[model samples]
Every structure is written in C-alpha cells, then in structure tokens.
Target: MATLTHRRIPGRVRDMPSDFPQVPVQDNETSLDGPREAKAFLYKFSQAVEESDWKSFEGLFAEQCWWKDHLTLTFDKRTIQGRQGISSAWQSLAPQRKPRGFSIAGPGIEMVETPPAFVRMTPQMATLDIPFAFSVSRPDCACVGIAKAIPSASSWKIWVLTTSVVSLKEYPFQPLPRAVTSNDLISPEQRGKATPQGLPHFQEALDAVVIGGGCSGLSNLIMLDSIGANVACFDLGSPGEAWLQRYRSVRLHHPNFMIQLPKYPVPADIASTHLNGAELAQYMSRAVQDLKLPLFAGVKVTSNVFDQERRLWTVSLEEVQSGQTSTVQTRNIIISHGFYFNEDCPVIPEGLKDRGKFSGPVQHTTQFSTTDLYEGKRTVIVGSGNSAHDIAKFLGDNAAVQSVTMLQRSPTAVFDFDTFHPFITALYQGNIPVDTADFLFSQLPLGILRDWMGGAIAELVKSSEKLYSKLEAKGYLIDRKPNFIQRVYEDRVRSIYFDAAGAFDLVLRDRIKIAHGTVVGFTENGLIVKDAETEAERILEADGVVLATGYAKTDLPKQWAKSGFLDAESALQIENMGMPAVDVEGEMIGQVTRSGHPQLYFSGYIFSAARSFSRFVAIQIMADINGQAPEHGLP
Candidate 1:
C-alpha cells in the first residue's frame, strides 16, 4: 500500500459580498426593524467574538435561545439551547482552538417573523445576510461561514450559522497512482491471439463480469481487483455517470464516514462532512483508477448464455458509441445495476393519454434539473419523496417561479437532519475510525436497530411538537407510524425526507403549495387531480409538470431478457429465482440454476446504508471467488 503526505490547508475569513441579495422580508417587524441596527449588532458581535469575550457574547443572547451548528467551528454537530449553555459550550473550547481571525459582512439584512405559537423565542427576529470567514493558524485550515442573526432580549444575536470548508476547493485529496504494473494490464496485441479458454473470449476469460459502474460497482471492482481476481467491469456510460446525472444540487444526506468507498477512505481534509453529486462522482472515478480495475466504459452487455456443461457464461458486449461488438466468457456474473434501474412514472388512467392536447412539458424527476428553465412557469411537482421536496424547495426559492405546488398522494415520513446528526457525529467525527464505527453499527441486528431508532424518533417528534403541529396545520401529511426508520423498513422504499433543506418550511409558509390527491389525468392547460378522501376533482393549472414518482424495483433477469442480454429460458430461470435468500455464510441460496449460472449474484439494492452494505457485498464476492467464508455475515 502507498501513502500520501497529510497536509492541512490554511483557513481564513472574509467579509460578505456587498451586492449579495437579502432574504425577502416578512410582514411583521418587532425589534431591530431595519438593516442599520442589524449591521451595528453584527459588527459588535464579530468584535466580541474575535476578542474571546465569552461574557459579552453570552449577554447578547436571550436566556432561552437556540444555537445550531452544522460542521462549522467545532468539526461536529451541536445544538445548544439557553444562553448559559451556549456560553459554557464556547468557553469549554481548548485554549489553542480559537480561530485566527473572524469577520462578517453581508449583502444586507431582512427581518423574519415567526408566529408566537411556532417558537418559544421572540416572534420577530432580524436575519442578517452576512458572509463570514474563519481561519485557524495551527492546522492551516479556513472556512466560509454563512451566518444569520435574530432578535434576542434587547438586541440582535447570532441565531443560525452554517459553514463549508473552503480549502477542499483548492486542495482535494488524490488517490494513489494505479497499482498495476505494465504486465498486469493486458495489451490489445496480447488479447487478440489469447486463447487460454476453448470458448470465444474478448481479451481473456475473466474470473467475473461485474455490471454497472456506480458507487457499488466501483467498490466491488476495487475489492475484487485487490484480491487478484481477473474481473472486468462494464457500463453503458462513463464510470460514476449515475451520480453525475443527478440534479445539480443533490447531496448525500449521510455523513462522510458513512459513504466512503470500499478500501478508500475519504480524507478528513477534503470536505469531510458531506458530498454533493459532482464530488462523489470524482471520488468514484479516482477509486476506479487507483485500483487499476479493468473498466469498459460506454459498453453495453447485449447477451449472456450459461453453458451448463462448460460451467461458464458466454457474454456479448456492444460498444455504445460505435457499433462495434465483442464476446467474453466469465466464471461469474454480478449484477450491480442498482435497484431503481427503471423509472416509475404514475400510471395514466384511460382517456388521459391525449399527448397532443397538453401544451406544456411533462417529464420524470430524473429529467428535471435546475429551475432556471421554469422561471415564469407554474410547475407542479408530483410525489413526496426526497427528490420531490428538493425540487419543490428549489422552485419555491426561485423568485421568478410564478407558482410551485407539490402533489402528495400519501403521507411521507419526514425527519429533521438534526435528529440523526448528533449520533452520526458521535460515531464518526471523533476518535472512532470509520471502519470501527461501521463495524459497531453493523453489529446490531436489523430489527433491534429499527426498534431503537423508532424510540429515538418518537422522542424527537414529541420534543418537536411545535414544528410538527405547524406542518400538520399546513395540510402536509405526516406519518404517525413506527417512526421514520421503521417506516422505511416496512415500506422497503426510502419514503423519508430530511426537513433541514427548507422544503418543509416552505410548505408551511405557503411558498410551496401542497395538494393532497392522486393525479387523475392531464387537461389541455393543466392536470386533473382527485382528492383521496372526497374524490372531488380539481384542475391544477401548470405550464410544466415534473413527475417525482421515483423508480420501480428492477427485476434484473427480466430486464436482461428485455435488453437481449439473456435467452428466454435462462431469463425465466432467473426471474423465478425469487426473493434473495441468504445462507448463514452469506452466499445466495438457490440462486444458481441447473444450467450452470455459476454464482449469479445480486447486491447493492438493499434498504440499508449503501456504503456499509456495499463493503460487506464486496467481502462476500471476494469470499465466493476465493472459496472462503465471509469475514462478516451477508450484506
């Protein structure tokens, strides 16, 4: 194994941009009515913070105020209530832990007024649209802080502060160079005349043919390659293209440690809290390259036939870009194409398929990107999943959007990100290594974990009655079942949304309308949605419709058959393979057929955490190829 030198990037803070736009002001104004007072308060606050005047800072906040930190200042998640608690938390910082310098400036300020019924704090609060910078000298790291202020007793105080490390942009962690020597990567000349196996093969007979090139596929390939297996990976698009194709704003809800690729730990310095789509894609590509895995990008598998007598799989591959084709033989096949291979749009009832009559664009959520194109249009986003909420929030935030509505046919389980943040922080942020944390987390049985999480969620809901009550009053359906995690387990689908992304707040504010109904059909100018309870139909006028209905569970064998990758008989055999049943040793029970589908495997489609599950899957694959028991139970 090769190692890279650890370097800490320097941190710095800068003033907010002068021309930055402020948040739109609300109708009510109490204390700190305008930007003038807010600006003065911010200046004084920054000065006191720089001077380490905990006493002065403590005096600014009310006796009972909320302070939330998201991966800023502390490199951990923290929610401190009450001025004394906040002061104690700050005062407890190590002597050497003070930021080198901190400054604040902003585009402007706006006053946000919350209903007295919604919060225990003052109803009227001033929110400064300030940009802040924090730097530490010892570690040489810097970050940009997006800070806001609210009215406390007699003056304005810091309410919410969110930070993103600035150094990750300039200094990202790079994977080690390719491990394969010259002889390891077979040359085209060598491949042309190679006939190690009697069957027709491209390059050579591979130990395994791994399909798909997303996070799961790449992780499996890396592990197999490390174990010296002759494996080749194939994908219809570029490696990591699945992640690259997500919406621009899509980000992993899990923390850094939870989502690391197999064998490759995400360096702590490279934005080590969360990753957006682009960052994740880059990391996947690097992992593939660093492992020197044989990845055939832009190649699609066209046919696969199992030869029972030979105990081998004859596979045909087609180059998607060019019309070229080839063949290969493999001892094993691993389907890593993900669970949601098929997009699931709502079933349009009879008489609703008049495509020529509808005037606007209708597309699945996968096809929808930023809201730049829908500027003056009234858009209706269908569904209540994470994507739906994200899209709705994006559209609601866009000033140019005439109107945005989210149509939810059923209740969705939504939890605030804060509920899980502290636990994740405790598990992965401090002394605990990611592998150790993952091992400890996996040690708990699925049912036990679900029950524990249910209790925690119940407590969280009870504690946040004000917030939940507000959501319910706004007509948003909230699931009152076994909490979010248990509900997810029961449904076998990720039907939960993290509420910290501002979507729930927007719904409550009526900035994003929520319509509870099933979409019956589309009219010439809009959609006909029927209420579930009343069965009353209402026309929702929209210039565009986004179907955030999610994807169908992919039947791998059936998909392969439809795509001409498997013969009818073999496809039927696999179709009947039924629900995946795993033995105690983590091997698939009854997955292989009499026709010699040597260890046809399914992975990466479970409801648990994908990264952790993929790690176990890779181990299982390695164990199967090497004829050893898996170190851990099946994924």
Candidate 2:
C-alpha cells in the first residue's frame, strides 16, 4: 500500500447545546450529569481523528473494551479491539488517509419507553454514530464514513470506523469526489470466495439440539446447560453475521446497556456506548467466550420433527464445515431460533428483474455495503428506513457517482444515536418499571395540553437566559431540563426532520437530490412516480437502484403447522402487524405443532408482536423471555 499524507478539509459543524434540555443525572437511569464532559470528550476525540493523533484515540479506550462495526459489512473493518488496539487499526490506515468535514456531539438523548421485564440489571453501555467525509488524494475525491463510538468512563471513544470511496456518477447532485473501484476497497479474498453454501447435516449424537445461536438461543442454551440439560446450540457461522450482513452505515437506536444478554454483559470497556450491527455481533461472540458457553458455529437447523411414539422432538442439523448429517432428541424443546435469518427482499420490479437491461449494477440493501462498487455510477436508492439513509449518506461523498436520490413512501421516526444512553436504553427496552399508560397518555401527540405546559416551561427557562438559574427558580437546579414528553415527541419528529432537513440541505447545496411521491411502478430504464397533487406520473432514469424498503417477518416452518399442533388462526393470534404477537407479559402464544407435543415455546425476534418496545434491544428481549418462561413452563 502506498502512503498518502493526511490533509485537513473544511466543513460545516453542527451546534448542539452543552446542556440544553438537560435532565437530572439519576444513577438508576445511568444518566451523565452535564454536557461539558461530553462536549470536551467530543472535542478531543475529533481532534485526534483530524490530526491522526492515534495515541489520543487509544487513550480513550477502556482496558477491557471490545470493538465492533457490523453494519458496514466490513467484518474486517477497523476496530479498537482493546484500549490499545485503537492505535493498531489506525496506524495502518493513517499511512494513506485524508480527513474531510468534522462534526462533534451529533445529537441529544431522550427516553422512549419503559416497562418492567425479567432483566433488572442497571445501565452498562452507550454508543453514538459520528459521520465524516474522507479524502484519499485530490481534495475533490472524498468518501463518506461513519465512526460509531460508545461512552467509557467520563468520555466517549471510537469503537468502529467504516469508510468507502464513492463516485460522482452515484451522487451527481452532490459535491463528492470520484468513485473508487473494487480494487480500491474490497480485498481479493472477500470478492473471490463464494457466498457460504448450505452445508450437509452434522451427524453428531446429541442429547438436546438448540436452533439459532443469536442472543435468544445462546441465552436459552446457557440456562438449559446450567440446569444440567444436555444441550447443543447452533447458528449459521459468523457468530454475529446478521449484523455484519446489513448495510454498513447502520447503528442501533438503543444503548449498549439494554442490549446485553444474561451472564454475558456488554464489556465495561467497549469502544462505543452505542453499537452498529458488527459491534453487536462481535460482542455476542465475546460473550460466548467470556461465559465459556458451549456453542456450535456454522451449524444450521433444517428441521425439527416430533415423534409421537418416541415422545420426543427430533432436531435435524447441518454443519457447514464438515459434510455430515445428524439428529438429536431432547426431553424438552426450546425454540429460541429468531426470525431475521432470511432476507425479506421486495418482489423484483416487473421490468427490472432482468437487471442486465438497465445497463447498471443493481443490488439489494441486504447486499449493499461500502462505496467501492459505487464510485462512479449514478445511484437511486429506494426505501425510507435507516438502511436507505445510511446508503445515501455513504454514496453522497463519492465523486464518480453522478447523483444519489433517496425515495421515500412516508416520513419515519428518527432519533439521535445518543438517545440510546444506557438509561434511555433501559427505557427503550421497556425494562424500566415506569408506567406505559402514563407515558403514552403524556407523551403521545394527542397530549396537547401537557405538551403546551412543557412548552410554557421551556419558554420561561429560555426567557431567563440562564438555564441553570431558570431551573433553580422553578425549584429545579439543572443547566437544562429535558422535556420528557416533548423529548419523546422530538425523537420521532426529529428523525423525519433531520433526514429531510439534511437531504434538503444537500439538495440546496447541490450535493444530492430528493424526490417525494408514490412509486407507481418500475420500468426497465427507471421508476415512475405519481405526484400527489398533480396526480400525474413522472419517469426518472438511474444507473442503479436499491430498495431500502424494510424487512418482513420470516416465514414460519410449514412442518410445524402441518403437524396440527398449531392452527393458522392461532399462529395469526401470535402475530401483531408485521411482527409476532407477544403479550405485555412477554409471553409468545406458542402453538404445539404436533397437537400433542409437550410444552414448546418461541422467543426472540420471531416473537415480535409482544416485544414492541424492546425489539431493538436484544438483552431486553432475553430478560422478558427469561421472566415469562416460568408461566409457560419453558425450561
């Protein structure tokens, strides 16, 4: 690799109050008292990156920290393994890097939902998403990258960094640098290896078989084994592959504290308080090691058949590494397997299915990652979720990409990465004992009277000109008091606002483009949009298009339902909208497929309906399942 001297590029900075809408730091909530600490930390951290100050960045890590960035699909992306590992990853990248645009203290924190669950543990981790532009050689050549960080001690530090060079053709409207070819980013090995093929069954003689090694499966296995239940758990290899398989720029909305699984805590020394998909997955892997839990990697459970004569559930599995088939019989069956394994890709656009005709490379969000493949192509990303935002922002920095447009169906609720502080994380996980009815009544949009009161209080405080004095006068003594309900409202409100606002700004500045309308259909050449007011359809051209549309629930096993243990209606009873139906009690109305099958249960993401508030937080789901298991006799 050739060494490139680092140069600083000027960019706009966002102004976030050091203590605006501040709240009292409650120990139980894991709140940090003031913004001075946060602001200073951001300043120093930003400086380190700006100047390639590796030592300063390294100094920010905790001794026991773990680093991860799965969303970028850069499984081998830069991570500060331990406090010192920060320097290791950076030193290598520093030799050929340039810095462009810097913004510190991206967003403020807010609580979402709080409910009591099985896990009562306090807040333990925090994470943040930091955005930047990277320049390789000429000043005009820049790419977008994300630095996801978490809180350590009194300051924040980088946990993971994923950058990709983009092209002008991809973002013709944006003022980004030229595109980088696959040779510039992806390694030969990554591109050459075939996607992992399904393996033959592993013929291991096991007493118990567990499917899905994600948090839920891992947790169930740990408990079953602890109770001396002979058990073997399995998931497709890559430990936290799902996280790695996502678009690279994604970050969790909740903090690390609420995401940790039982007996496997988020490391006290994590690189960031918030985590991206990769980091979360890495943490899961570390948990397996730290807990010394027995886990089978690269193993997939193809089927689970129950035998009426044997009075046992037969679990069939395939080991990707070794070509063999195996079956196991368990005294009791625990279905902790989650639902995110398969991709819920949209029905291929009628005319675009034969993508070769479009004369451009098109891909799914599931396969979308860095900008190496997008350096010089015009890109149109479909969908309005976080995945779409990440890809748009990433491609916006490319020079070769002619233009980038993010198509949306409707506005979405967006929140700052910081809103996921450990305390807030707990709140989002619905683990806090706060009243849900009260929160909804007080926080929902219809609660106008309460919002007005909050607004009045805010006005008075602003009038005082001194937040601390205003707080003290109101029998409060904080620099700023976070409007609980307003904060909640802002979380949803700001997501739509920020993305739209940011996209609008990009448009005004000619950095990117935005279109709002209903997608009528897809043509071989481009898309047709129906204008809401004019009711007229307009066609647009593009070099490539990506569906940022969200995912759907995984299809349930046909075999299980075929056994007569579960009825279609009863199954629907468990489904809430696109998610699975879970009771407030976190109980999944599991059906015994065999009709006479013994007590069987379902937990994890597949059980989405009842997991509403805490679905984003895996640890919360684990706690809920553990707490509710006894009621269903799930052992």
Clash numbers, per candidate: 8, 63
Best candidate, lDDT-wise? Answer: 1
lDDT per residue (tens digit) for residues 1-635 in model 2: 00011111111111111111112333543343323443455567668866778887787654544333211111111122355654565555444443434433122201112211112111332344444433433212324444445554565554444343322111112111112233222122221111233332333333345566766776565544433334456677656777787677666654554555643457876787668778877787776655545566776666665555664566666667775767555534445554433354343445444554455667777778777676666678776555666678768866777788876554443322322133233343544322221122222111323344355445544544443342233221132344433322222111222232133334445566666666666666677777767889887777678876544444454433554433443333232222333221112223111112233344444211122111112211222223311111011
RMSD of 1: 18.3
Overall lDDT per candidate, in order of appearance: 0.56, 0.44
Which clashing pairs does model 1 show?
Answer: 9-140, 10-140, 10-141, 10-142, 11-141, 11-142, 12-142, 13-133
Please list the residue runs of candidate 2 whose C-alpha ends up more than 4 Å from where it truly belongs after superposition: 1-208, 340-356, 416-510, 553-579, 582-598, 606-635
lDDT of 2: 0.44
Superposed on all Cα atoms, model 2 deviates from the true structure by an RMSD in Å of: 22.8
